[model samples]
Target: RPAYIGERVVTPRTPADPTADSDKVVWSQTVSLLLGALCEKSWDTEKV
Candidate 1:
């Protein structure tokens, strides 16, 4: 049902900046470790 489902190609209006998303990230090893442990207990490895 989506436009790209067939042979249509989707292109962004502007070139993507690789660092653009990283700029918004809150880098914290503490949070990463907490989430990693939580994910291990919950068996949701995809989130980590």
Candidate 2:
């Protein structure tokens, strides 16, 4: 009988942030930017 194929192995490994535990901070920053754009509150506003 012939040998069967096994699971594939990856090389070089995938890039990642080992220190990150969750995406809470990322989502928070995204939401903040969205709110700012919706309210037209940017750093270059001259209507202050």
Candidate 3:
């Protein structure tokens, strides 16, 4: 877990774990879903 040190959260002290192509695909999908949800909420449907 990451720790908060007053103003900033402490970065990981070790190297990042290796991720495979499948992991990247899943991560991008998750990110796109979150971005889409945010855009939908911010869009004005009545004006569309």
Candidate 4:
């Protein structure tokens, strides 16, 4: 017999807290900006 329904899988990693520290927020933004810059550079090279 074939199974008709699928089982749900849960992730081991937990979600971040909504009320995170100010330092954590600042660091996250800084890293995001760096990644964005890198992506833009790569995209520009591709267009050339």
Candidate 5:
């Protein structure tokens, strides 16, 4: 769920960086999604 949400948030920023190449921009969003997922996973795990 956080992956999906983060993807939505990051998707817009992905194309916003005109200074960066397309591949780099895409990679940024991928990283963002991964981080978001990790954060959510950690939070959920801590609750148990």
Candidate 6:
């Protein structure tokens, strides 16, 4: 794969066993992204 200028690749290794700590981090990210999406939707609706 050719790398483009300023392009970066990130790889995150998964744990052999899913632990509570890792799950919590993933869940928190999910929640934050969901909230951001919801907020954007509401803001767009309000602007309409």
For lDDT, the strongest prediction is: 5
The TM-score of candidate 1 is 0.33
Which has the better lDDT: candidate 3, or candidate 5? Answer: 5
How high is each candidate's TM-score?
0.33, 0.39, 0.50, 0.57, 0.56, 0.60
lDDT of each: 0.48, 0.47, 0.55, 0.57, 0.69, 0.63
Give the residue spans of candidate 6 off by over 4 A: 1-18
lDDT tens digits by residue: candidate 6, 1-48: 886322321222444545754665676678779999999999999999
Ranking by TM-score: 6, 4, 5, 3, 2, 1
Candidate 2, residues 1-48, lDDT tens digits: the string is: 653221111111333642342344455567768988867866557576
Better of 4 and 5 by TM-score: 4
lDDT per residue for candidate 4 within 1-48, as digits (tens), equals 653212111221233643444445566678779999999999999999
- Best-first order by lDDT: 5, 6, 4, 3, 1, 2
Question: Candidate 2 deviates by what RMSD?
Answer: 15.2
The whole-model C-alpha lDDT of candidate 1 against the native structure comes to 0.48
- The residue-by-residue lDDT of candidate 5 on 1-48, one tens digit each, is 346644544455556665565555577789878999999999999998
lDDT per residue, candidate 3, 1-43, as tens digits? 7543321312323326334444555666787799898888778
Once fitted onto the true fold, the runs of candidate 3 whose alpha carbons sit more than 4 angstroms away are 1-19, 44-48
Judging by lDDT, tell me the better candidate of 5 and 6. 5
Give the worst 10-residue stretch by lDDT in candidate 3: 6-15
Candidate that beats the other on TM-score, 2 or 3, i.e. the better one:
3
Q: For candidate 3, give the lDDT of residue 23.
A: 58
Candidate 1 residue-wise lDDT, 1-48, digit = tens: 555411221232333753533332333445667889987978865655
Q: Which is the leading candidate under TM-score? A: 6
